[model samples]
Target chain A: MKKTKIILGIGALAIASFFMVAADHIDAPAVASGTADITDFYAFQAEDPNNVVFVANVQGLLSPSATASAAFDENVLIEFNIDTTGDNVEDLVLQAIPRDGRMYFFGPTIPGSVGVDSAIETNATQTSVAISAYGEAATATTNAGMKFFAGPRDDPFFMDFAQYGEIIAGNATGFNSPGVDTFKGTNVMSIVVEVPKTMVGGSGTINTWVEAKTKQ
Target chain B: MNNIKTILGAILISAFAFNCSSDDDSNNNEGSMSIEPDFSGTYTQQDQMGRPAVNTVFVSAASKNTFNVTTPDAQGAAFQPMFQANLEGLSPAFANPGDMNALMQTSADFTGLLATDVLNLSLDGETTFFNPATGALLTGRNLTDDVITIELLLIFGGEDFTENSQLSNDNVDANDKPFSASFPYLASAW
Candidate 1:
């Protein structure tokens, strides 16, 4: 048990180290090369208020041509952490990984540990969903009263980089009401799971966050 | 009569000004504060292309000015969410080919998991080319072996931005950041 704790602590430390890499906002000549680095995370209610969607995007500012050939990281585990209570701890988790051409999704199940260390609860009512190989190909899975989708598609984040630069240079003070998006006409990999409102929590406000777990 | 009228008007104006000022002072000021992302915690992931992904994960941070992880979560469980590819469009995010290689986050209308579509991928897109084995740039994606544009999202959870404060934002991500002409990989932390 003590060894398990140590492993979890080390994993948390590593994650803590990388967590601060900022979204795509370049200023220095040296770091400017990595703007394609990941920029943000979004989670919200779907069109059908009954469900919640979690979206994670990476590799910002690629030329459409460059974005075309990008590949995915096989070692990373995209895990959605759900905190039914206000404690900011994950009560249930859903993880997604790709094997071959198909993307696989697991859970809505309770995680063994809520913070640093996590083990797949294989004993739980596990569900597997295949990703739509093509973009926007609609394939769904109903698990724990939720629907899941794993696949690739277009990039959504938008920004007017020129305008942002102008603002940063002090030429302009503030951004337009809704600033321009530089990420328009791009693409990203997407994994989606729609869970019933009840599954999330008792309808009261609950804070939910997403995490990417790796094998230590 | 004109002098009297002018004097009376001045007094009336002063009274009106005072009344307005008082009213303004009593009015409550309300506004929402953006939850600053904490720059300290870890939010990193590997690409999908590499057969053996980065043995070590990389932290993807937000910019110092825009985002930061102010507080770290006390309880564990939630790992920093990572994208598989860049998704196009808003909400009901449509996937593309960016997920396999990197996590792309920016403040825009559209964002999603990190992978782009096979058809949309480009020669520069695959991880096998740069990350080799892992960085294989896709071929036959378009008329030319071009680099596909990708979008990433960086979330620092809750951050603090007070009027008077200094911060060390290592994770620096932005649209203006550079890219390699040939093959390359990028990482950051704020």
Candidate 2:
């Protein structure tokens, strides 16, 4: 048991070092460019005022050439957690997973269990969409008042990392009038789900987060 | 809203019927065959995010993994002090006692909110990330939202949007590509 504990301590130290190199658009060195690396999460009011869209972008900084071969790992499940009670615990979860070139979705329903571990809400309302290819027209599907799409898209989070480094290093005072975008030409695997307001119950407000969980 | 519900109800019924028939159809276009997904095992959390750069900026390197796994409800109490210390060290806007940002939040209050690391989205109002015009703060995030700039402004812009002029904004004002106008609104991959 002491040996096991030491091994775990070493592992934790290694991860801590990895975090020094990680940034918003990237992650720890262990899973830096892996499919489970979540880059960004966005929840916005849809064009239809009654609907809200949640997007989770992963595998950041893919080049145009690299994007063609980039694919969602079948083993990773992207879960969107919604908390309506202002308690920060997830009251409802929407899960998406890839299988056989298509993306399958479950929930916006109450989860069987919550927190770091998850079981796919297989019994919830299910929907599927053909995962779009790199250079093809986007594919989307709607079912049970929710729309789903999954595939590659431009990394929308903009940053001037080089300049940021300069500022952090005390070499620069502030940002330039028109700083260069460090993530201008990169790509990310994105999963988007738009659900009606009626489905996600809250008093017009909710706390939401996204997590990438790999099958254990 | 009622009309939309009526239309959606009709669509839902049709979709249910179509799904029932497609379940038996062998030639469904989605894939080779329709099968219930086997979600029998546990999935361990690997990475998590809510607000765009909160985790990247606030959580210390040694605590990144710990913060990622810690539930949001528990995060503020666990990390707020660390976040406040970091903010006071990094940003001159919070350099002194009782210094506040444009939001009128002291370093402690600001860091307290940032420590939780979850997006607070408004379901009924305009969704945006700190819109200057309408004062819509954290209702949600839009694809085209200049989130980094807003975050920078809050961190360094100081009271009345005039402190630390050099550190106020990133100057990368918009997304590299235009977002789509329809559902699944992200721009095409480059």
Candidate 3:
């Protein structure tokens, strides 16, 4: 009963990233409903069309023993906001930050400027990797092109809360189409990253969002 | 400063003496067990009571691990935004929207096994969040607007990719199972 750390943005101007569910767990009065707090965000175009991919999820019903020592809140700074020509503002910028466990990527390059206030191009170049250790498998693979993973999986989200609670108790008739999946047997706590679509845009239509910046 | 105010007054009485009253249960019984809140809906591969299980898969991956999962294009993504948040004072039957939430939530999630099918995986270790009213064990420390779900297991493609692990390998496949996983997608927490 002492919460006070929410700062989600949209048209207002932190823009991009405000929950794109693949995983969602909110209620009990919308417990910090930061854009519904996404559990999945993926962008495509990379078999070498240049390269692009981004995943963002924040503490959404985590388990597997609290995602086995959950890490990556080093003040939180996982911004992968890019909006090209759609007038969403952000032209091209890719940022990822995680201290010790190693996950420090930044930009596709050009960023002396790009909507709002994002100054950390660090010379329009930066990359640091090493955050895949929790059930191990990727002991050093995708670097430069980018790669990083934080623990705990499963919870890819599936629902049917008792017939969606009998269609909000109207008795029924609305859901049941693909219903009944009361979180199978839940779990959450994943923060993965894989990029290479020539960075994030060198293809067709574009408009992306993923943010969780907390360092005041 | 007076020995730092006597070690911050003994760490605030040892953080309220870390509670130890033999405890009883009483989340107030708001929703009694809470199950309906609204998060939109869509999930195949049944079996919780309604039957039908397996052959409901949706996989998406560009995973290399450095973080860049394309964005949208999952298939137009018209609206994948599920919403509903209300737990009234947090616990004790909660009472409000159609009332009946005493809070005892648990949505564990995690076990994207691989490393050799985690040696015929089979481990369902449990730790699915806790709060039976005021027992409190919420993840992310003191969980508030709590509601979370995620289960996306995409073992391997292109020949199980021989060997290339990095989930902080304890030798990979650290079994804590619910078994039956065949990649693609599975994000839970409705």
What is each predicted model's overall lDDT from 0 to 1? 0.39, 0.86, 0.36
* Highest-TM-score candidate: 2
Badly placed stretches (over 4 Å) of model 3 are: A1-37, A40-55, A58-94, A97-147, A150-155, A158-162, A169-179, A182-190, A193-216, B1-136, B139-190
Task: Report the error of model 1 at residue A1, Å.
Answer: 57
Off by over 4 Å in 1: A1-38, A134-136, A171-179, B1-71, B74-190
Where does the lowest 10-residue lDDT sum fall in candidate 1 chain B? B48-57
Question: Candidate 2: what lDDT?
Answer: 0.86
TM-score for each of the candidates? 0.45, 0.86, 0.25
In order of lDDT, best first, we have 2, 1, 3
Q: lDDT tens digits, residues A1-216, model 3?
A: 123234332342222112112222331122233322334443432233344334455555454555556666555555656654554445666666666666666665655654333445655556666665545543333557565554445654444444434433456544443334554444554455556554555444545555444443
| Cα error of candidate 1 at position A211, Å | 1.2
Q: What is the lDDT of residue A165 in candidate 3?
A: 41
lDDT for B103 in candidate 2 is: 90
In angstroms, give how far residue A179 of model 3 lies from its true place.
Answer: 9.0
Q: Categorize the docking of model 3.
A: incorrect
TM-score of the B chain in each candidate versus the native B chain: 0.15, 0.81, 0.14
* Residue A84, model 3: Cα distance from true site in angstroms: 33
DockQ of 1: 0.02
Model 1 chain A: ten consecutive residues of lowest lDDT: A20-29
Estimate candidate 1's alpha-carbon lDDT, on a 0 to 1 scale.
Answer: 0.39
